[model samples]
Target: MYTQCPDCRTVFSLDASVLAHARGAVICGNCETLFDALDTLAEQLPPEPFRLLPGHTRSEEAPKLEVAIYRPREDVPVAVAEAPAAPAFTPGFVQDRRAARKLPRRWPWVVTCLSLALLLAAQVAWAKRDVLISDPTIGAWLRQACISLGCRLPLVRDVHRLHLVARDVQAHPSVPGALMISATVRNDAPFTQPYPVVSLTLSDADGHRLAMRRLHPSEYLDDAAVLRAGLAPGASAALLIEVADPGNRAVAFEFGFE
Candidate 1:
């Protein structure tokens, strides 16, 4: 027998045993529509281009039933009867209601894991700010980002990379009992660095330490702008220092950067 789904108008073929097992309720394989199999039931398909009627409606006139009568004739040869072909059954997929219900429950955990990952990255970045800022590539990227963020980075300081190229100490021509110290400091690092504190140590002919002095950037650099700009990479700065003469006892002097 054949039945058509009312919702999707899909035809399916099944036996009386299958229809009885489900009590005429069947699901459509194509549209997954649950409908009664008893409705629109047919023994054979209707003629071409003819619409199938609903279960409740019928033709105005009753369908005529034709009876077949069999008679044996000695002159006609007997033909063998062929068995009917089995009906084709299409299986329908059952929707997983539990899986659909579980889908929404997964989102909270997913969002939480993503937020934790971002938080951990932020913490690591904060803890290693100095190291990351010292890197050539990362520092350049950070500097460009800071421009748009209206933020400033502290100047890099590597005292070991600072060197005193030349230095001299002599009596001040204009000031009595005072000494004038001049030195050229260079930055050998690949990146810009802050001006270093210049330390001058004086010693006697016998190698006995006599006096010590420290000069800050503000004290040595006469230009305010240069003091704020810091020393550029591979650049040198000449600094002049005026101090009271430590006396003839101080014969030798050495400069160190800090």
Candidate 2:
């Protein structure tokens, strides 16, 4: 029953059930200071310079019990050793500050699931951007990423890869009743496309239909720089058309593309 530590005077051999479960406060495993083990509550050991009993005071009341460090070992025979019961106040830096407050609550759900998986992969790459820009290696890497994102890219039309190749019609040696026609086309697509919509039709010599037209890359491209650079992969172009004579029973003609 001897207890001393009024600030490290270090004595400790406690056990009236460790001072009735420490209602007599304890701490000082060599200077960890805390006091009142019944204020130097002794049963012996009073012969040293230690002094504290004429009406012992120091208890201001706050440490309700937690035990473990009981020091008495002079060759070990002072036996009633029951102090080992401490762990309730959970101190290992308070469980490392509650594991650092559970890492900021899992970093806001790991930054909200990585910002919703990058906004669902940017809405599936903007909803398959025209089937991923018609894939010629993803349309040349999305036209080199839309030229630094200034953004334009749309041309690549396929029109069964456009073909025609050659054609002719006749009689317009200067437009009397007009009817020149002519053609060529080509672009068997490996990528660059665009100029198509030609169509014509005329028929009859029994083929029936008669007079139909469509034309348009500015009415058959009279070369304003090949109507702006389109149709390149395996290129070709020609075209000329004139029109007027859907009479003379149009002797059958046809062609189409768009």
Q: Which number leads on TM-score?
A: 1
Model 2, poorest ten-residue lDDT window? Answer: 76-85
Q: Which stretches of candidate 1 lie over 4 Å from their true place?
A: 1-102, 105-116, 136-152, 222-224
What TM-score fits each model? 0.52, 0.29
Please give the range of 10 consecutive residues that has the lowest summed lDDT in model 1. Answer: 76-85
Error of 2 at 31 (Å): 71
Pairs in steric clash, model 2? none
Local accuracy of candidate 1 as per-residue lDDT tens digits, 45-87: 8777756644745468987868858766666333423555578
RMSD after CA superposition, every candidate: 20.9, 18.9
Each candidate structure's count of clashing pairs: 0, 0
Best-matching candidate per lDDT: 1
Clashing pairs in 1: none
